[model samples]
Target chain A: MALAADPMAPIAARVARVRRELKDVWTIDIEVGSGGFPFAPGQFNMLYSFGVGEAAISISGDPARPNTLVHTVRAVGKVSGALTRLKPGEFVGLRGPFGAGWPIDVAVGSDVVLVAGGLGLAPLRPALYRLLATRENYGRIVLLCGARSPRDILFRIELERWRRRLDIDIEVTVDHAAPDWRGNVGVVTTLIGRAAFDRHHTVAMVCGPEIMMRFAASELVNAGVSDEAIYLSMERNMKCAIGHCGHCQFGGDFICKDGPVLTYRHLRDRLARSEI
Target chain B: MDMVQSDERSILTRAGLDALIGTLAARGYRVVGPKLRDQAIIYDDIAGVGDLPAGWTDEQDGGHYRLEQRDDNALFGYAVGPHSWKKYLHPPRLQLWSAKREETGFSISHEPETIPPFAFIGVRACEIQAIAIQDRVFLEGPHVDPHYQVRRAGAFIVAVNCGKAGGTCFCVSMGTGPCAKSGFDIALTELLPGTSEPIYVAEAGSEKGAEILSSLPGRAAQPAEIEAAEAVVTHTAAAMGRSLETAGIRDLLMSNLNHPRWDDVAERCLACANCTMVCPTCFCTSVEDASDLSGEEASRSRRWDSCFTMDFSFIHGGSVRASTKSRYRQWMTHKLATWIDQFDTSGCVGCGRCITWCPVGIDLTEEARAIRDAPAQEAKP
Candidate 1:
């Protein structure tokens, strides 16, 4: 396999450490160079291993922490499984911080509504942290998270901390729950009916499974949020972080470069495609 | 400017041309020209002018190609080959990204060296158009491919006017050939013996071409030589055995997406990717990764990928185009219909390289004709 000497290729990163977040899900924290990989919230990196293949994974670390890059991956395929088994001091290839990220500047003054499902919360975590760090810049911050079951819920400790904060409204829901569960037990979409929001002045950033985002976006729209004000993180098979490889193309736009974060209006038609 | 006679435009005699090549080699320019490679003529680096396929000519038709030796010993005895100008400019596979593990962490590797200047010897008019089309894709786009730009910027084209058109060639219909056009820096028309005039008409289309010509031993072409060049072009146009009716071809293919002809062709199509491999303008690729046995380090690379492959359109669980019919449809639709929407021009240059190189000999023009002639089917009420 010949490598095209790309100018935008990211430096090789090593898994300095690994922490298991859940069963089969591990968080690999890589220690890059001094000025760690600087990436905006919602941008993804293409991680590759020799013999195995490459995958587009979101950078889950806060942009403020540049030296330590973190990625929470579920072991599904050869590359992801190989990545999970990577020990401390193991080397892996990385290329990116590619694609348009969340519009932090635009969301500064508006009330932020973060809607995430399951592992989708990984990419949005950075944005949530960024907003919390600059708490005085924005209005009330609302985080509505959903998971398949009580056991699948991520960032449980952080969710509890956000709930204790005066300026944040955090809601956690699960599709199915045990008899011992005392918290909200319903689909994430059902909880949307009870939440109070200033739809006109709010920016809703949703991520997760495509079906979840679509249903969430529809719920947000019905609640009076405009399509332009709703942002969604799209998932696609991206081979090249650059626009040359046609794998990630949704019609004319290369999702790898043009987006992973796109306005609901921009990707409405493309998202309607059966397989996109 | 007064056009000189063809005999007067001899910057280098047949022997002098060989000497000039030696001079070029001494200067460090890798001189590449047409040579017999594999079973067909291909461009490769040559030590001298004698390396050129002297008396070999090719016969091409829809799904057919053969090479035969001509009695006359002409330097450029053959028509175009499967290889295009892209082999030098936009290579089939390039390393766009590389990364290596470091003590502190991992460091990504980018191309450190600039592309070396090269001299192309036997480019044709249709291929010039193909190069221009690629320029739009690589250069004019929002994100420029620095690798392609560097190589293309340093390339020196020596275009040849077609004196004989192949059976599958429809450059006349595509308005791309039979004669050297504007994109080339320098153009040449080979007028061999036995004709009313025997000469090689040469002209500079760019300042660099003018400089190269001034350095060489050529003079201004005569009026008769210019007329002879025109006659050769006209003769080649007349010799074209294949012609595509480009009149509303875009719309015809776009509207007839469900035509039964595509299924018929799909049955014969091998999906071997030979057509795309030989085509001058099909530019699709896929990336792969490689690691040492220990999995301590890894390298990611890209390779030429064809749309015909089952893996090309694979999404989550299965491929979007699972059947050979759908894959062929997508490839053809993207080439003839959707390409106009993406790029401003049609993807096919009517060079017929795809038709001749296809293992099953699936002819695009024949498929188009079949769809065009098919009767309209009524929808069920």
Candidate 2:
């Protein structure tokens, strides 16, 4: 019988541009034809590096600009390393816009608090861009970012430009800073106490390493934010973006489908358990 | 000649069995049935009734399976063997798609699937439930597996009622069955051997089954004869070798994640992955990519993966489930607890294949009972 188009098969997308974001991180802009790869803020794509393998990467670009799909990849593994090494005009296979994105809509009229750690900023960037573009749709907006050091800060130019605006509050920190580093020198959770936002009517979105997310989520709770008001972007080994491969399963949820973005209320019990 | 016809009740003589097999084969179906091979009854291509494991039954227990001879020439007296019906539907390995390099970019193309419509014979009630569970995984999801959809679309199922329970069988506790129900084209109950000859009480579950039944050499069964067929299943249900308390099982396992019982199971488990491989409802798979030496052609394929494997939960630096305890916990929890939350049903059909196939004979029922019998001091909090 004639088979239908495979959902797993990736469409070939040409690399529009590649910019080195850090020592081991690079952001690639992929051209996905004129139709535009429209996606929500916190979703991810399965990027296949030709002759190498596939990696799950969060969409790091502006959702407003759909034709140029942006993914910030860390060269920590074989597939991501292959993708980071690709030059402009090269081709990569793309299958995605998968998983639940951040609850930006739920944050309308409510104060928005964004917490990002290390490479975690990439996934949360789109939600930040959406909030900034609308500007008037939400209450007070606060962005707290943390990196390993001053050199590891992502989107430094953009963070500076956003800091220039009077409407939004921005805080940048480093875990271990050099003497020349002038910013706060502590983990991201330390910044949560001081950020100005209504604790009762606030929505928090956090993305980072598992340990960072765990502590950040607890700190947000201690800051009086409700569990349902907080969201965390989770990561697990994924093969099929469509939930066929069971690698990305976390407890009862398929992190690829039920979330990469999940409410803290849903993850409260599960997140506490180890090796789940 | 003055017999009241009943669609649900018909008597099939020994010759009628051959006629049923002939009817399916005539309809361009690759008839698959149980056969004696490698000292076990495994499902394979069957030509006719001669290929069935006649006068043979299987003795199964934890980490044990042996072929035994039954006194009567009963065609399907076995409980379950190593093979399940999943191999025909999901398959062990399948090529998802292939890609070719072009001057500017690459192009992806799917290999057109030509799945032969399968007619499975002698499927058990628990096996039918297992198929339904997998259906939820592959077809009922938001993204349907087109390959599995196609294979399942035209498939025909002929379910058989169990007359005798295996040493590891626990369908009664799982609420699946010893009697076929719901998901089948035709259901048959082999009547206990009487004076004259071997007879079967056949019932049609679908239109195709009815049509096929009409063509077979059989007569409308008497009311007493149908009761005899029902009695066969009732007797087998009471003979179950194992029983699991499924009440609050989801909460029980989730709450006891760090229980000391896990460490106990880890001590005995070899992490051989035999349970996951034998499980009929385990739908986990892994994708693999291969490229030609010239790098001109590349293909991606999906293969069956076991949760017991250290590589199953791999991330960037290392495998998440490195220890045998964690892997076993993941498998059992997913099957009993998380599965209901994910698919709205238990992942296990209580087929007992996992119990019989494990090298170390680690019975999940015993493990669960052990944990239930003695929870850690801090297991609740």
Tell me the TM-score of each prediction against the true structure.
Answer: 0.82, 0.97
Please identify model 2 stretches exceeding 4 Å from their true place.
B1-6, B195-197, B376-381
Per-residue lDDT for A1-276 in model 2, tens only? 566657888888999899999999999999988899999999999999987889899999999999999999999988999999999998999999999999999999999999999999999999999999999999999999999999999999999999999999999999897789888999999999999999999999999988899899999999999999999999999999898889988899999999999998889777887787
What shift in Å separates residue B158 of candidate 1 from its native position after superposition? 0.6
lDDT of 1 by residue, B66-141 (tens): 8998777666766788898787777777665455555765565665655556777778888888888888877776
True contacts kept of each: 0.39, 0.61
Best by DockQ: 2
The candidate 1 chain B region of ten consecutive residues with least summed lDDT is B1-10
DockQ, computed on Cα atoms, for candidate 2: 0.64
| Chain B fold agreement for model 2, TM-score | 0.96
